[model samples]
Target chain A: MAVLTLAQALNQGLEQALAEHPEVVILGEDVGRTGGVFRITDGLQRRFGPERVVDTPVAESGIVGMAFGMAVGGMRPVVEIQFMGFSYPAFDQIVNHVARIRNRSRHRFTAPMVIRMPYGGGIGAAEHHSESTETIYVHTPGLKVVVPSRPADAKGLLASAVEDPDPVIFLEPIRLYRAVRETVPEDPHTVPIGEASIEREGTDVTLVSYGAMMKETRQAAEVLAERGVSAEVVDLRTLVPLDTDRLLASVEKTGRVVVVHEAPRTLGFGAEVAALVAERALYSLQAPPKRVTGWDTVVPLKKSEQYYLPSVGRIVAAAEETLTA
Target chain B: MLQLLTPSGDVLGEPPLSVDLTRRLYRAMVYVRTFDRKCAALQKQGRLATYAPFEGQEAAQVGSAAPLDPEDWMVASYRDAAAMWMQGYPWELLIAWRTGDERGGRPPEHVSVLPPSITVGGHMLHAVGLAWSARHFGEERIAITYFGDGATSEGDFHEAMNLAAVYGLGVVFFCQNNQYAISMPRTAQTRSETIAEKAIAYGMPGVQVDGNDLFAVFTATAEAIDRARAGDGPTLIEAVTYRLGPHTTSDDPSRYREESEVEQWRRRDPLERVRIFLSERDAWTPEWQERLETEASTEIERAVELAEGMDGLGPARIFEAMFDELPPHLVDQRAEALRSVGQ
Candidate 1:
C-alpha cells in the first residue's frame, strides 16, 4: 500500500482497468497527450497506447454519444468530461440515449460504460469550473451515480464503476483531488457501488454527506464531540443506489439526523435522505431531520464561493438543532 | 449525380448491373413496398402503433443496404425499416416494434442492425463509434447509418460527420433526402443546396444520386462501402428521393404539402422505374411479378402472426432490463411496482 492523492488513486485505478481489460478504452478531449486538463489521465496513453487511450475532439455530446455506441458495440469505454460545468452539452446524449439503451433494447443490448467528471467547488476557477450537480444524474434512472470522498474510496469506487454492467456517472470531487491522501491498496479493489461507508461511529446524532462535503462533515463531527455530543459521520459513496439500510440504521441508532451537501437546498440529495428517514424511521427521530446545503443559486465565483458552499459551521449548527430538539 | 437508369425506365448509359442482379433489386423493392403498405393497413386496423411508411424511398433504402456485407453494422432511423430489413433485420421484429413492444428491438446476434432510432440524427454517432471500434480491432467491417433530409439539421449530424472525417473511420453516412422532415420541408431544414455537399466541409467525398434509380444508389453505396473497407475513410451519400405517403400514420401530409407535388413525385416512383426497366429488358414476366407479390404477402402474414402471438412482456422485465443486476433500491421499487399491479 502507498499513500496517494485522490487524483493519483483515480489514475492508478484507470491504469489497472486498462491493463486488465482489452475492451476497456479511454476517450475524451485532451485525455491522451495533455494527460487531461486535471492530469488524472496522465501517462495513460503512453502506457496503454493510443488505441486504448483516445483523445477525442472537443465535443461533449459526441464523446458521450460515441461512447454509448461503443458500449453497445461491445467495448467498455470510459469517457471523461473535463468538468461538471462542461457536461451540459452531453446531457441529451446521456439522458436520452445512454440512460435508455438497455431498456429501449429490452436487455438484449446494454451500455456498460463510465462517464467521469470532476465536480464540486472550492477551487478558484472560471464560471463553470465549480459546480456540484449530482442530483441531475441521480434523478435519471438506468444510471449508477457514484461519488468518492477519499483517496482509497476514489480508487476502489472507480474500479467498481468501470466494472458495473450498466452506464455509471463517476463524479470525482475536484476539491479533494490533492487535498487528501490515504493508503490505497496496490492491488485493485472495489468498494461496492450501492453501499455507504461509516467514517466515524457515534450515538448522539448521524451526519450524512458524500463527495466533498464529507470533509466538513467529518470536521463537524469532531467539533460536536468537543461539545460532548457523539456524531456519527456517514459517507455515501454511491448516490443513485443509496445505502438506505445503512442510512436508516445510523438514524435509528442516533434518533437524530443532519444531511449535508454542496448542491442547492431545494431538491438536493439531502432532501432525499431526509425523506427516506421520515418515511421509514420517523418514529426513531428525536427531532425533525435538518439539512445543511448550498443556497438555490448558481455556484458563485471564487470570492463568493465560501458563502455558497455548505460550511463546517453550518453543519455544526444543524447538528445542534437536531440534538437540542 | 449518378444515374444508370432514367426516370422513364430508359437506359441512360451502359447498365452496370446484370439482368439477374437487376431482377433481385426489383424484387427487394417490391417486398419492401408490400411490407410498407401492409404496415399502414395494420396501423389502420389498430394491430400496430404509428408506422413510418417508406413508400417512395424503397430504392434508396434497398439500394444502399444491398451493398453492405451481412456482418457489417447498420444504424438506421425510424423511416429506414426497409434498410434495416435489407441488412437482415427480420420483418417480424419490425412489425413487433411498430406494435410498441421492447422485445422487438432485440434483433438476433447475427443481424448487425441496431434497433431503429426514433430520435433524429442521434444514431449517426453510433455508426461512427461502431466503425471506429471495428477499425481499432483491425476488422474490415464498416458501418452505415441512415437518416433523412431533416436530420441533417440536428447538431448530432454535424458532430458525427466531423468525427467520422477526423478519425477517418470506416462508415458511410447515407442520407435519404426524401424532401421533408415530418412537417418541415428540406428548404427549411438547411440553406445548403444539398446534403451531400455538407460532407465536403468535413473533408470527405460526398455524392448525390438518383434515389429513385436502383442502379445509381446501389452503385454509389457499393463504391462507398468498398472505399471504407479499403481503409480510405468515410463517404457521405445523399440519395435524392421523396416520401410518397404521410410521414407516419398519425400525420397528414395535406397540411404541409401540395398534392400536385405528390403527384409529380409519384410519376418518378422508385419501384416503377425499376419495374419498367426490367420489363423493357425482357427480364421480368407478368407471372413472375404476381408470384413475387404473393410470396411477399405470405411472408409478411406469417411475421404478423408471430409478432401478435407473443404475450406482452411482464412488468418485471421493466426492472430487469435496466441493469445487468438490479440494485437494492430498484429491487424495492420493483417489489412496490409488482404489488401496485396486484401481481
Candidate 2:
C-alpha cells in the first residue's frame, strides 16, 4: 500500500472501477486530458482512454442528465460536478429522475450512478467553490450520501458507490485533498455505506463530525486529552444511512455530546445527529446535546472563512460546555 | 412542411408507405383515438385521474413512433401516451399509472420505455443518454424522445440537442407543436418560424411535417431513424399539429381558445383523411369503421379491467422500490408506516 492523497485515492478508485467494469464511464468537464479542475481525475483519460473517462461540455444538468440515461441504459456512470455550488444546475435531474427512477419504476430501472463534487470552505477558492451543501442531497430520498475524511476511506467508499445498485452522492472534501496523505489499500475492498467510523475512543464526552471538520474535531479531542478530558471522536462517513446504533452507543457511553460540521447552523446535518442523540440516548445523557458549526449565514470569502468554519477551540469549548453542565 | 395527403383527402405527394402499411397505420390511429376519447370520458366520470388526451395528435404520435424497433428506447412526456403505446408499452400499464398507482409507471422489462416524464424538457437528455449508451456499447439501437412546442423553451432541450449532435448520438428529438402550452399558444413560445429550424444551429437536419398527415409523419420519422441508425447523428422533427382537447381534463379550452379555431382543425382530423384514402380503394366502408370502433372499445375495456383489478399493495411495498434493500432508517419508517396504518 503506497501513500496517496485523498485525490489520488479517488483517482485510483475510479481507475480500478473502470478496469473492473466495462460498463463504467467517467464524465465531467475537463475530466479528460486536463485531468480535473482539482486533478482528482488526473491521468485517467490517458490511462483508460476517452471512452471510459470522458470530458463533457460545461453543462452540469446535461452531464448529470446524460449520465442518468446512461445509468438507466445499463452503464454505471461516475459524474464529477466541479464544485458543490455548481450542483444546483443539475439538481432537477438529480432530484426528479436519478433519485426517483428506481422508486418511480418500482425497481424496473435503477440509476447505478455516482455524482462526485468537492466540498468545504477551507480553501480560498472562487465563489460557489467551497460550500458543503450535502444537506440537500442527504435530504433527498432514494440517494446514498457518503463523505470521506481520509484517503483510505475515500478510495473504499468510492469503489462501493460505483458498485451500488442505486444512485450515490459522493462528496469529497476539497480541503483534505492534499492536506493529508496515507497508505491507501488496493482496490476491490469496500467500506460499507451505512456505517460510521470511530476516529478516537474516549469516555468523558463524544465529538461527532464528518468531512473536513474531522480535522478540527480530532485536534479538539487531543487538546481535551491534554486538559484531562477524554473526548471520543466519531467520524460519520455515511450521512444518509446513518449508523444510528454506533452513534447512540457512543452517546450512551459518554453521556454527553457535541456535533460539528462545516455547513450552516440551522437545519444542518448536526441538527439531525443531535436529534438522534436526544431521541434514543436522552436518559443516558448528563447534559443536553450541543453543536459547534458554521454561522447561519453564507460561507464567506476566504478572508473570514476561518470565522465561519468551526475551529478546534470552538469544538473544545462546546465539549467543555457539556462537561461543565 | 411536407404533406402527402391533404386535409380533404387529396394527395400532394406519393409517400413510400405500402397500402398494407397504410391500412395498419389507419387501424392503429383509430384505436388510439378511441382510447383517447375513452380516457377523457373516464376522467370526467372520476374513474381515471385527470388525463392528457391526445385526440388531435394521434397521427403525430402513432406515425412517428411506427418506425421504432421494440428494443429501442422511448422517452416521452405525459401527453405522448399514444407514442408510448406505439413503442409496445401495454395499454393496461399506461392506464394504470393514471389511476394514481406507482405500479402503472412500470412497463414490462423488455419494453425499453421510460415512465412518461411529467415535467417538461428534462427527459430529452435521457433519450440522448440512452442512445449514447447504445453507441458506446457498439449497438445500433437508437432512442426517441417526445416533447411539445412548450418544451423547446427549456434549457435542457438546447443542451440535449447540442450534446446529441456533438457526440453524433443516435436520437430523435420529436416535438409535437400542438398549438398550445396550457393557455399559451405556440406562436408565443418562440420567435423562430419553425421549431425544426432550431436544429440548424446544432448542425443537424430538421424536418417540419404536417402532423395531421400520418403518411408524412411516417416518412419523416423513418428517414430520421435511418439517419440515426447509420451513425449520421440526431435529427429534429417538428410535427405541426393542434390539441383539439384541453391540455388535460382539469383544463378548460374555452378559457383561452376560440370555438372557431377548434372547428377549423376538426375538419382536418388526422383520422378523416386516412378514411378518405381507404374509401377510394374500397378497403374501408361504414361497416368496417363500425366494426373497428367496436373492437377498439372491447380492447380498451379489457385493459381498464386489468388496471382496476390490481390490488393487495401493502404499506411495506411502498418502501420496497426506494433501494435494493431498505436502509435502517427506511426500515424503521416502514415499520412506523405499518403501525400508523394499524397493520
On DockQ, the leading prediction is 2
Cα lDDT, all candidates = 0.92, 0.92
User: Could you give candidate 1's per-residue lDDT for residues B286-329 as a string of tens digits?
Assistant: 89999999999999999999998877777776788888888898
TM-score: model 1, chain A: 0.99
Native-contact fraction for each model?
A: 0.70, 0.81
List where candidate 1 sits over 4 angstroms from the true fold.
none
Tell me the deviation in Å of residue A87 in model 1.
1.0
- Give the 10-residue window scoring lowest on summed lDDT in candidate 1 chain B: B309-318
Give the per-residue Cα lDDT of candidate 2 at A288: 93
Model 2: per-residue Cα lDDT at residue B160 = 99
Indicate the docking level reached by candidate 2.
high
User: Residue by residue across A2-58, what tens digits does model 2's lDDT show?
Assistant: 899998899899889988999999999999989999998888898889888898989
lDDT of 1 at B126: 92
